[model samples]
Target: MASGLLIEEGEKMRTEEEMFQMILEIAKQDERIRAVYLNGSRTNPNVKKDEYQDFDIVYVVNDVIPFLNNPEWLKKFGEIAVMQEPNSKAFGWGGDHNEQESYTWLMLFSDGNRIDLHLDIKKVALDRYLEDTLTIKLLDKDDFLPDLAKANDQFHWIQKPSQIEFHGVCNEFWWCLNNVAKGLNRHQIPYVLKMYYEIVHPQLFQLVDWSVAQKNNFQITTGLFGKYYEMLLTKERYEAYLKTYPNPNPEAIWQAIFNACYLFRELGIEIAESLGFSYNLVEDQNMQRYLTQMYKKENDK
Candidate 1:
């Protein structure tokens, strides 16, 4: 007879119910584990449910050191395909790399289940639990978890931009393009792509989100990195947004930059006009001219 604690090998992907049961059973067996709760997409009502979503579980423990010292207990879930202990000294995540106030283990089982599990002392968990509204209590062995409101993504809502914020985004978009231009002109593909995606593109996307918010009354969630962009943007606007992504080649890269500039201009002006905010047309024109000269230079080479 197989022990209930050991998840059988070659088993099909466990259903949510099975996963939850196993999680609770593990907590129940370990007297050190005080309570268990869930966080992230599993707790987000607005997020579409999918098999790919991993369990983001947190266990409030009497003490974290025992769990940290003896991690072999996690094997009860299944054979670990891979795992990461972010708080471990090998990871050097942040701080002194040895701090153990709270610890996290992200694991993927051979049965195709992933769990990002955190162990925190009861005090540490209780003090910071309310900070993320996307949370749900799974088990409370001693009634340690407080009554929480229905889990929501309200904390992730897009906010209305102040005038200063508007100006700052615009300034960042235009100013950073110079770095992209210089990289492109020097035929430094890596530098150009890095600047385009990492530095410049985020500013453009922020403007795009703001424009969407302007139409939608600034009360929406674009779902982290604007994942909802395709759904939120109009067909024409979304198509334009796609053009901002460029291939590694010089011509394609340059064209993508032009495409980005065009989209930013149209959206930026529309937003400024609607909000009665100043749009620095002269600064925009000068940057456009600089981009054209750089493109011409790249072509001449």
Candidate 2:
């Protein structure tokens, strides 16, 4: 089992209170930086503290031109072990959404803290502010920011899916499960699990989360491996989900593969029913059973 080293290290890296103080001290003298706000795990109380926790910060700046031109100004925060400017042509994973005018900097530090700094000339703050749910006003020099309520996880909440969307996820999950079966038959354990994890499992878990989120008002993250799922999920159901990953033997692996098919079929049906979609569990179940039988016959031969 791969231990969660990234999350554990992030908790040990820095104190939130100290980081807040440092940001405030810097903002006091820097006239260009008019306001400071935080986002991501720092604001999320439910998230466990770790060194990998990013400081999702935004600095509402004055001109935003001179600083954007020279990225060195950011080094004042700390000796940057390494960094990324998402908007830069050299590294444009997230391209400039606005014409050449609007600029945002997405940075990851060596200490494992990340900051997504958005630069605006103060004129566009109001319009941009209303559009995003996670925007929190920390310090506003001109008192332009409204008296906002405490931050909530509403932005990250699982939205209720449409019938079409629910069915689409189900279709994708079952389709990918066949790939896992094929990989396992070919003695490719990595290929089998990769498909199982990335495609099939995510769909199953997403629906489960969506169902729970609907019940609880969408306020939690289940973590990557359903790490926090036990809080919301029954122990029996959670254990059942775990059964989908059996020991990696050709004979024993089929039982696990079948369990995945069963679990996904059940969950997908529930999700589809909730959204008023036609559940196709019969079709998926038959397909999964056929795949399992074929793999078993081939192994025997």
Candidate 3:
């Protein structure tokens, strides 16, 4: 029984207040539930509010045994369109908590609403609570949740890199670029693209974002792999990043490789400058140009 109802065109979707009220009402009836907390985007002020935001709720229960043993306890909320227990062996967690026993259930309702509910029996510690992005104490019977400051942007702070970490990131980015070159030479389009996406892109974007954060005091997300690079980068520089993508023609593979080299060199230089380290952009450019010409000549034969 699955149904998708598109809300009236331009009608306001259900609010967080409405969802929270419903969760609270359920908690009030269940005495075993000691406390309730919320996490994820709903707690992050920086994140824009929209219908897509999920209600990530947690219930601190007295004993998780009854709930964990019987699957039917979840029906009290609403008709579950589908449910996933990440902690269950079927999915992954295997009902084992090394430190303290806690169970998590992830649910999606029929009305396009979702909740990540966790039931923990242990006492809520303040230090551990603050480690995650954002959390709010919704209800407390014994009043275990700490009296902490409201959620802030500190959770996503840009950590300063050690000398070793800096070198490691540079080494990884350069080494992975070799795989992209190899894949292109062998005419393996998927392999080349995968290597670029998995290794080169993340390092390049992370470096750029880290530099921006250092300059501006680490306030923004940089939007998931420089997806919003236009907002953060100059038109010229953003255009350069865009040009890094390789054209599909086997004959044009060398051009693509050259593009990757150009983009990576630029990113590396940017990273080094931000960290006050020296970089050899000229050396990279020479090597890249030589390789591209060699590949082009070989393919032309």
TM-score winner: 1
Model 1 clashes, total count: 0
* lDDT score for residue 17 of model 1: 87
TM-score of 1: 0.91
**CA lDDT of each candidate?**
0.86, 0.69, 0.69
RMSD of 1: 3.7
Q: Model 2, 264: alpha-carbon shift in Å? A: 1.4
lDDT of 1 by residue, 176-236 (tens): 9999999887878998898889999999999988888888788677877887788888898
What would the TM-scores of all predictions be? 0.91, 0.77, 0.80
Flag clash pairs in model 1. Answer: none
lDDT of 1 at 40: 87
Candidate 2 lDDT trough over 10 residues, lowest sum: 1-10
RMSD of each: 3.7, 5.2, 3.8
